[model samples]
Target chain A: MCTMIAERASIQGSGKTENAWISIDSCDIYYDHPDHVDSEHAITLSFSNQLDPINSRISLEITPESAKEIIRKIKAALSKGDSLER
Target chain B: MKNYKTHDYEGLIAETIQFNSANGDSINAYFAKPLHKGKFPCVVLIHHLPGWDELYKEFTRKFAHHGYIAICPDLYFREGNGSPDDVAAEVRSKGGVSDEQVIEDISGAVDYISKLDISDGKIGLFGTCSGGRHAFLLGCSTDKFDAIVECWGGNVIMDESSTNEKQPVSPSSLTANFSGSLLGIFGNEDTSPNPKQVNEHERLLKAENKDFVFHRYDGAGHGFNYYDRPIYRQEQSVDSWVKIFDFLDNKLRS
Candidate 1:
């Protein structure tokens, strides 16, 4: 089923494709069927350059637990880095 | 009810052809027909949100083998080229195909098949998931189809608050206009059109005095017919296929 559950964010970042690094202008996070994942549903983090085609993007599909863990790790790293700087 | 013969000649021709759909967009379609010299009913297949994949081609041929001319149009032709999954992912990001465009494309297919030399002018619709929703939509929007088979179509009873440019209205709202006999195949475990929603759909049809039948499987969930997926249920899938053919035979081959 197409959950149609999605969220979009406009951000600036650089991501690697097959052969080159491209400037990504947008990111889309959606929970739906995965293209390659074995699970019926996965939370996907997709980064894309609007100039390129829609499919020409770097994407990740992981379980809900994995997504939460990534979020935790990112916050932990940021907090520790900030403390060190201070 | 079998679409085969024990001791007779059997063959079919399947190929890809392009035709103008909505707004004169030339879209590709896979068409299959029996080689025998006889008029046959046409089944315009509506591929699911998975884009135009190999499974649908297999379905087109399966119908042809059973003496029906089948055609599955590429609903995502305007979205550019890529693998089926890639294209489907892109379509999903874009909020799915618009209901109006799909209806026009399907209407065009019906028109195209009606002109075929072997056409019996009896057209039916078959679709799964989102495609199933579109099938029911078209069946109600116009009197073009003689039969409709909708398999696990989600969002048929859309929330009014969620209506958008793509899907402006719920299909259930248009049940009063339905002209064809319908066969609904659903799984009770499905989330989108859960058992309660299915009951609502059935109730709406009954109130309108529409010609429709529904079958629900207890253990099966969404996409149970998708053999490649983990949710596939062999017992339910086989039984549903038999039901589909029997329903089509009664409605279209009359």
Candidate 2:
């Protein structure tokens, strides 16, 4: 199974950074990037919403751990003051 | 303190009005107006899935108290309501009314407002639940609306298969075509519009370079705007009302 993470943040003031980590299905995606990244660069995790065989609905589930990791990356990007890649 | 009815709010007076829709289906609508009104900006209110009821009436009155002429047309004319439970049961049993019918009824209401001497021709749209979905669709289709507020609408993004199967209006597709400013208020606990759906909507809006605002209230469930409903969240409702008024005032007022 593949996991995805999407994070976005709007920061206020300077010299302060916020970190967030997100864990989903026992896999952790952490966001610890430096603060130099622009706030507009949101981290996105894209996947298909398709299911095979059974009639179970396909959904994208986000766990708090994964959210935290994405937030951490965002804060790191902001702190480093660099453009984010993806 | 004595319990006052919702209509007892200051600066509002409720009246029943009849309007003709594009399909020539006569629509019965409730009009809420300010006590001192002469050429005030108006709002064409659309009701949710179960159709027009007391909750929608109260909402119109509240909007009237805020100085806008709020007209709520009966979207479900075929199935009349005996009670709230009846409305809910009907909605669950019959799914949803056709989107084309909704747009026709809304257009009729807009026409009614345009012909009114007391209206300034500027109109905004607001609705909850299914009505919210209609508001978004109508707002996207018409340039007449200055502002639109949608609360907890569902199935915003539809798959190609679903569209082919049901032929329903896809709000996700409509977002890119929206020219008016939109305000979407959703409950954090609304499973219909999960975080993923919300994010998808945001992404579409951003990609299309559309102007919009989305607010998700924590600890609130679906139908938080209805004061008498079980899912009502008083604090969030109050806050959302404030934001709605501010948005309307800024956009609709000349």
Candidate 3:
């Protein structure tokens, strides 16, 4: 598609990066061209705090299959408390 | 190297320039012109949604090398400066630039070009993707240009459910207000301004008795002229570029 197929979904998680612990306030996920990934289209997700543009950014670009795998792994990790990785 | 023909000395000066729009908003733009002195036709090149990046600057230089003055305003200038991709991402997350503000900025650009000592009093307009839609919008909204070329413009037909909040009306709706000659290039595979939409556009223009030309290339999709993207169609882009230049020369020069 020419325009982004995007959605504003809420994410619950916090991660530390660049010597700062940034809480993700907003998340925008879309299926579109990935800047860093050399793919025509991919699942792009950005976890950010709208107020702090600099501190809160965890961008991920993954293939559809990879995204599904990540979802599966995440579910297993949360349920089992310890999940096996391939 | 490809033996490209040049009508003048292929020297140019390109740099970032600041210009105040009619709204008193100072914006940054990539300004380029031929180093050689005579008055030259001006081009107000609107950058695509992909942020005003290196490719656009290259286009500016290309025009300058071809003996024309060109300026591509950074539409994201109002937002704090950031990398092109980051700026684009931020703008998209914020729902993009407003159509009214964009129109005002474009008005300023046209005014700026008209006052330049090196200007030949002729201004050519060009844009692709979202910028392409803006070119068509400006064409109908004002008589500030001599020629306009819109390449694969999306959202001009306005899918209401998918329309961005910033753009309240479809450019197609204002077809009756269009002035000067317009040259539109599209891809048969594009869905935004698909073949059906293009047909309707032509029909409306004909009904209004406006002077415009439209062409659709097979085996090409949206952003086909974008050399760096996966959608690039080399043959069609080359053909389209030729058409754009010819249109400018025909309308602005003779």
lDDT of 1 by residue, A1-86 (tens): 46788888899989998998889888888886654566667799888877765657788988778889999999999999999999
**Candidate topping TM-score:** 1
Q: In model 2, state the lDDT of residue B217.
A: 95
Arranged by DockQ, best first: 1, 3, 2
Cα error, candidate 3, residue A71 (Å): 4.2
Comparing 1 with 3 on TM-score, the higher-scoring candidate is: 1
Clashing pairs counted in every model: 0, 39, 0
Q: List the residue pairs that clash in candidate 3.
A: none
Q: Once model 3 is optimally superposed onto the true structure by TM-score, how far is the C-alpha of residue B247 displaced, in angstroms?
A: 1.2
Number of the candidate with higher DockQ, 2 or 3: 3
TM-score of only chain B in every candidate structure:
0.98, 0.90, 0.95
Off by over 4 Å in 1: A18-20, A35-38, B3-7
On DockQ, the candidate that comes out on top is 1
What TM-score against the true fold does each predicted structure earn? 0.93, 0.69, 0.88
Ten contiguous residues with the weakest lDDT in model 2 chain B: B84-93
Give the alpha-carbon lDDT of every model: 0.88, 0.66, 0.82
| Model 3 complex DockQ against the native | 0.32
Top candidate by lDDT: 1
lDDT of 3 by residue, B108-134 (tens): 988887899999999989898788999
